[model samples]
Target: MSGEFDFTGQTAIVTGASKGLGRAYALWLATRGCAVVVSNRPAGDGSSSAQAVVEEIVAKGGRAVAHDGPVQTAEAAAAMVEIAATHFGAPDIFISNAGIQAFRPFSTVTLEEMRELLDINLWGCIVGLKAVWPAMVDKGYGRIVLTGSSAGLWGQKQSADYAASKGAMVGLARSVAIDVPKGTDIRVNVIAPAAYTPLSMGSIDPKWADYASPDHVAPVVGWLSSPLCQSSGGIYHAGAGNVRRAQILEGPVHRLAEGDIDTVMHALDRQPEWTSSFASGAEIMPEMVKASGS
Candidate 1:
């Protein structure tokens, strides 16, 4: 069993905190003594969902503030960070969970529709990272979690736009984690979660909500956001009380021979079941040399 973790002096910014997974993450961190900035878009009624989350946290004697705005724009992301700084301190934890989805055939997915999804899912994370990265860099300590999806990990039918937005996040998180400065405790990771949020539960049976609830996935995200976690560029899948680590691997290069191109084509086309994954980009040349049999 792991020892207890604490976030007594930490501050967090959680996007889409008005409901679903984002709300759960805000509450999870706030209850652990982490001051939280609950960010989300305003409701159709013009009331902020974040306000209610902030009130709930305050009722429990936890510190929280509400920032109501779309996370897609740099201005809105900056506002969230500014609110965090004003209310608690520099945000050390950021969960870019604000996203939207619409299931449709890939052929039917128009450019305008894809643009909207990318603006929120992909560009939202980009702006959020840009907003708080400077503070984390200067402090040399931070935890960043990007919300990804299994659609990106594998693939899903009739989810072209959603998958595209999420796949971009997985790539973005990996790149950011790899580029973090040396000697800094700052880490960035992605989580591909399968939670039954409003998007799923509203259309399905209510009983299954207990089995795939957003609450079930919140703790996994908390662990990723904890200072105790040493992982960067880690990809995780969490939901329904099951947590897993995901990896991207590669097979050795198949050099083609000119002497008997057709004879060797079949061998080159065959994929190895067991192949090593890259430790870093720098390993490519060495691996290539080794594969060359030189």
Candidate 2:
């Protein structure tokens, strides 16, 4: 379906929009005519990244307002959400992209460090959802995008804590998608993106930078943020002009199989056929889904 995905007369709230993936998402939404609330951490050096983004949008005749503060704190997240309502109206779209990453071995990771990542990466998104959900519910329309990571999808050697944080997106998105009233027209999805932003620069080779530009991933997000997307609790991986889905596929029930420890271990070693996944968050029995050709 190649229908136009225009955003005229709409409003969006994008966290971490001062740069990176958030910046790309903000600019793309504005280009398509959506007013945006640009939220970012307050720069300590008397400079304003959020203001700079607002200026860029205004220079292009786009409507945007800068809100400074970290979303890691509920107070700051609420303030950031307030600007969207005050400036444009109840937020029609929300992209939770504000987060940080740390590189440490599981053996060396401390409780405080893990807690910090959780507070910012996972809890921060929860707060943003809590803040905007009521108004969106009242309006009876909303599109929510939560950021995930490859580290979370497939565990990383040096990013155990980060993986734990981002992995939470799956449960969160599905739960929210199922909880929304059946006819509300509200949908929540998760995008575990791989882009050449500050988040990945530390580890990726510089040569692959151009291939991994945020521009390549922005279109997928735009689609997720647009009316074209009809599915909820959808999980996707986007980068370098490539898009693929990530689903929780279940294997056949071995409840009837007879097995001792060794036999059971052998059965578990068999690769699960990619024949089925969950039908919805509320589903008690899993159903088979048509596997993608990709």
Candidate 3:
């Protein structure tokens, strides 16, 4: 029933928090009265980069801890959740934001490259979800935000692997929303952010820098991770301080008859008008579960 992002006494875990969007998310949560776990793989400087973020949060009178490890591994993800519970409490929010991107032509992409992308971008999310879902279920409440990308929704040249990995996240969010048991309070959503982060800021034109700042995307994420967000299985586009839901719609279903080429052509011509958008998994699954009595 709460429609505000007030997270007092709650805990949050944000991966890839050494910099960029993850850092913004961690800081935002901390400012809103939540204890935070900031995680990132160590840098070549042999320093725990996540610690620096934690330190900054602590300096601002917020509670935070750091975990430095490769988030693509399930063991590492589990360890993060354990640390969160040990230090603070069972996390109320889980942001699966750790990912990697490699741009190479589809024809020239190596198996190694694809494997790496899938492992870090897609599998990392699965690991995070698996690690924290049971805890959320036990508490009967949770907010899970999986990161997606524009490339994933619409194909991008030289980014086949990246697109595939991100696209899988969208599907994962939708399926999880549908499959979770009835009466569960868990909310799962995906954000396809067009932000200027270390991952791609260098390639962005200077003129658009202000509009694409990572800060602009953090609020949308915060909203989704709060009790304010009622919608699940949704894909949102957030950038330049604007937010909107991205829906997957289909043309009206038309019955097909066994027929020759002429009949097929006529059916095509008579296809229902594409006026209304399709319902999301959140909108479609409740009735299904009710019918099945599961």
Candidate 4:
């Protein structure tokens, strides 16, 4: 992979940056010449875990500030953006990386748990975007990266709430990309990351831990949150020093003459192949036409 992007004079806000993946992202951005806001919820002693991350970056002669709060709140989100603007400048990047997961089966999961998951995982991204979007629009440039999970892409047995939240993030990123005004440089994308951080490892499982370090995932995130990112509304899978694009592909269209069981059965019997996977809906139809021999 080519590391060929400049982040000079840029500012980045990374949520849940106390440790693990978020901390890695913040530090990597700092090394690339971007001032960073390290944000996370305060710890039990009323001190912020993000404070340590800020200290580490500053020790390395990098610019960083810590903002501690429940980022799901609009007030907290606005405060983070204001800190970024007041301390550094208008933030050029926003990494909506804060989230929580409940590991319970669908039938056993409580409504309260579901609500909390949706609030932290899905609503947090919306709140962050609301805070930074106007500044980005006015500046005519921004890179927004929403963190996703494999659970959302392929559901896991005991993560129904987590899966639902992540699935929402994917849709949110796509719609946000479409909503940006024309001729603007704002870009939004989602990453379904697979890293063995504190969140991934409840206990130290040595088998995957070495291979799935958070550092391995930071490179793809840096590229996605940089000016050189070529694609928006795209979902990338990153971890273990490997990266790949994930997309929703469609099979050949079976345009039926009538909505009948017999016609549907015939179409199913044909079992048309998917000629290609698309990054956006706009690319789907033309490829389907070619695949269908229409």
Give all TM-scores, in the order shown: 0.87, 0.89, 0.86, 0.87
- Model 3 C-alpha lDDT per residue in residues 187-253, reported as the tens digit of each score: 9999987766889755555555565678888999999999888879999877767677877765544
Question: For model 1, how does the per-residue alpha-carbon lDDT over 45-142 read when each residue is reduced to its tens digit?
Answer: 98887899999999998999999998899999999889999989999999999998787788888999889988998999899999999999999999
At residue 203, give the lDDT of candidate 2.
56
Residue 156 lDDT in candidate 2: 70
RMSD per candidate (Å) reads 9.3, 7.3, 9.3, 8.0
The parts of candidate 1 lying over 4 Å away from their true place are 1-3, 202-204, 258-294
Q: How accurate is candidate 1 locally (lDDT)?
A: 0.82
What clash count goes with each model? 0, 0, 0, 0
Give lDDT tens digits, candidate 4, residues 79-160.
9999999999988999989988657878888898889888998888899899999999999999999998766876666888
Q: Tens-digit lDDT track for model 2 on 101-215?
A: 9889888889999998899899989998998898889988999999987667657767877888888998899999999986798889999887778877875556666767788
Q: Candidate 4 — which residues are off by over 4 angstroms?
A: 1-3, 256-294
- Pick the TM-score winner: 2
Error of 4 at 262 (Å): 6.8
Better of 1 and 2 by TM-score: 2
List pairs with backbone clashes in candidate 2. Answer: none
Clashing residue pairs in candidate 1 (N, C-alpha, C atoms within 3 angstroms): none
